[model samples]
Target: MTSTRATVDHYERLAASHDHNWTHSGVFLDWMTSQIVSAASIGATDRVADVGSGTGLFARHIADQVHPAQPILCVDTSRPMLTQIPTSPEPQPVVAPAEEMAEWVTAGGGAGTAGELDVILLKESVHTR
Candidate 1:
């Protein structure tokens, strides 16, 4: 039967091409980003988490809105997928299941921060929840 392990493994193999398949640089993505960012009301100071942030499809755009203030956490179960994001020096990527993200945040994976998330996005990861 298909399970979370199988899902994560699949993503690990697909990580490199996930962005391309998702048309990350295309118009539809741009519009989606705008809508999500607007709906989330993400600001420079908002602490955000892009759950199921495969290849950073949405996290990259969210970063532009939150950068230099605080990096948005790119939380995903697959290490390969998390690593695909072009994020650095910001502690942006956290390898964790979407459902357990709050524990990671509270346990100081994102230390020195409050035990709350300002914004959480699960656009393509709703299945995980």
Candidate 2:
């Protein structure tokens, strides 16, 4: 059986390339992302969590829609994947598996002035849930 740790290690190894590969998805990704963001109706005061946030593509996209001070927690099992997120307002990289994300957040991982997450975008991570 494939263990979770082994899967995480694989993602760590592929983090950089993962970000690069998303570019090839092209307009499909952009359109899908736009639809998600639009439907999320994220407010400036909303705290957001992007679980399984590899390279923070979805988190980065939503950063602009949320408040400048609102925290966007980027939780992933792979540290290398979290590191791939480009510098922006401020991306909180929490290294943890999807299963433990709720506990981590409860322990103040993603807590901001606005409190807990108002919006959470799981995207391809639905399986993890």
lDDT of 1 at 15: 85
User: What C-alpha lDDT values do all the predictions have?
Assistant: 0.72, 0.70
- Supply every candidate's count of residue pairs whose N, Cα or C atoms clash at under 3 angstroms: 0, 0
Best candidate, TM-score: 1
The sequence of per-residue lDDT tens digits that candidate 1 reaches over residues 18-129 is 7777535557766787798888787877778888776776788666545637767777778898788775755378877765786776775545654567888887873642
The root-mean-square deviation over C-alpha atoms between each candidate and the true structure, in angstroms, is 3.0, 3.3
Model 2, which residues run further than 4 Å from truth? Answer: 1-3, 23-26, 65-68, 106-115, 126-129
Report the lDDT of model 1 for residue 101.
87
Candidate 1: regions farther than 4 A off: 1-3, 65-68, 106-114, 126-129
